[model samples]
Target: MNEWERLRHAMRATERPDAVLDLATVMREGRRLRTRRRVAGAGAATLAAGIAAVVVLVAVDASGSGGTAPTERPPPVAVAPPSVGVSPTSPEPTPPPTVARDVPPPKALGQVIDSGVRYGTDQRVYYLVRVSVPGAPKVTVGLAAGRRSPNGYLTTDLLVNDVEGADRSAGFHQIGYDERSSTTPVPTFGYFVGPAQRIIGTVDGQQVDARLARWSFDKNVVIFWFDPAELAPGKRLDGIIARDASGRRL
Candidate 1:
């Protein structure tokens, strides 16, 4: 067929509704043609370079056959692995909280809750717990006039041991009450003087049951707490009499 007729027939075929065309196909064809030309050009250039290199190598080989070719070669390039920065490790898991343990009660009654001898006072004021027969008349034995609470309220109910028996050079101190107790016990003539110890008081030549403990509020000072309720209902709450670890009365 003639070129004009063939062209007319191809156009009629492309004009059919099912034979759709778009700009994207045209652009893709253009890019493919350009890429092929570029590749062909590069291949021709490479061939020329290879031919030139071969000619130079032949000349060198003919010239060097009378001697020796240099054995030195360039070192191979090192390819490193893909780098990945290390993320900081998550913070250590938080630790659990601590729990408090239970403490046991004392075994002996009238045991000195706490006591200490200070050398600087003649008539020193010491905290004490006083206990005796319920109906027996209470006597003031060198008891202090009054000790106000820390909150500035005059404590009329404060039980103290007024030490009148000590000489001018020394004084004794103690406490036999738990300040944290819900119900207050009757103030007795006793105070904390040690961690745990026995207080031996004879009544009718028999031993009394009293317990004493020292609650350390800090390193330098401690409060004394005591329990005499374990004493026989009929047994008198004989005031706690403190003594040194050597068994000598303080």
Candidate 2:
């Protein structure tokens, strides 16, 4: 208002308004004002654009450094151990078969025979040949192949199964072959001939007398010894007869 009023007053007081008014100077001032306004607007727009560019750059840098990209790597995968294979074991080998020895044929009474006996046991078989004499109390004679002794001797025994006889307490009457005594020679043959308690019999039509004696090992068993030469193969005593000590026929 001051500038406009002053200007109007100066214009009215002018002696030659047309001449006082400097058209060229007025035109130049108007141009200068327009230039100053244009310059001010350009400076404001430049400042605003610079500020927006700075904010955008700052956001871009922040996102690049800390927003999406991962700082730490993922954890490593764990590895497992390999599986072990098992092998099958074979069964143990079968044991070998055992062989059994053959038993000889029985040649006489008390001789051993084969009854399918095997080793590793106390098993045996013998021939059964017996004689029975008649008496008030019967007397029976039997034979058996005894067990082998630890000294490696096999003995044959003749026994009276029923009654006891003279030797009550004593050792063996004789040992045919003593394994303990190396100097004692083996006898070729032994004989047992006697009037044994008057017990007599007939064998092969010959009047054969028996020597009745009790076993030293078992005093209860009465016995009679026989010569192997007198017993032929496949021949046994027939028509047997006997008499006891008290003259009792048996």
User: Which has the greatest TM-score?
Assistant: 2
Each prediction's Cα RMSD?
A: 42.6, 64.4
What is the lDDT, from 0 to 100, of the residue 11 in candidate 2? 61
Q: List, in order, the clash count of every candidate structure.
A: 24, 0
lDDT (Cα, tens digit) per residue for candidate 1, span 180-225 = 2312233333332332233443344444433333322221112322
The TM-score that candidate 1 achieves is 0.24
Error of 1 at 76 (Å): 66
Sliding window of 10 residues with minimal summed lDDT for model 1: 94-103
lDDT of 2 by residue, 135-223 (tens): 31222233333323334343332221223221221111111211222222111111122222333334545544433343333323334
How far residue 82's Cα lies from its native spot in candidate 2, in Å, is: 92
Worst 10 residues of 2 by lDDT: 184-193
Alpha carbon deviation, residue 23, candidate 1 (Å)? 96
User: TM-score for every candidate vs. truth?
Assistant: 0.24, 0.24
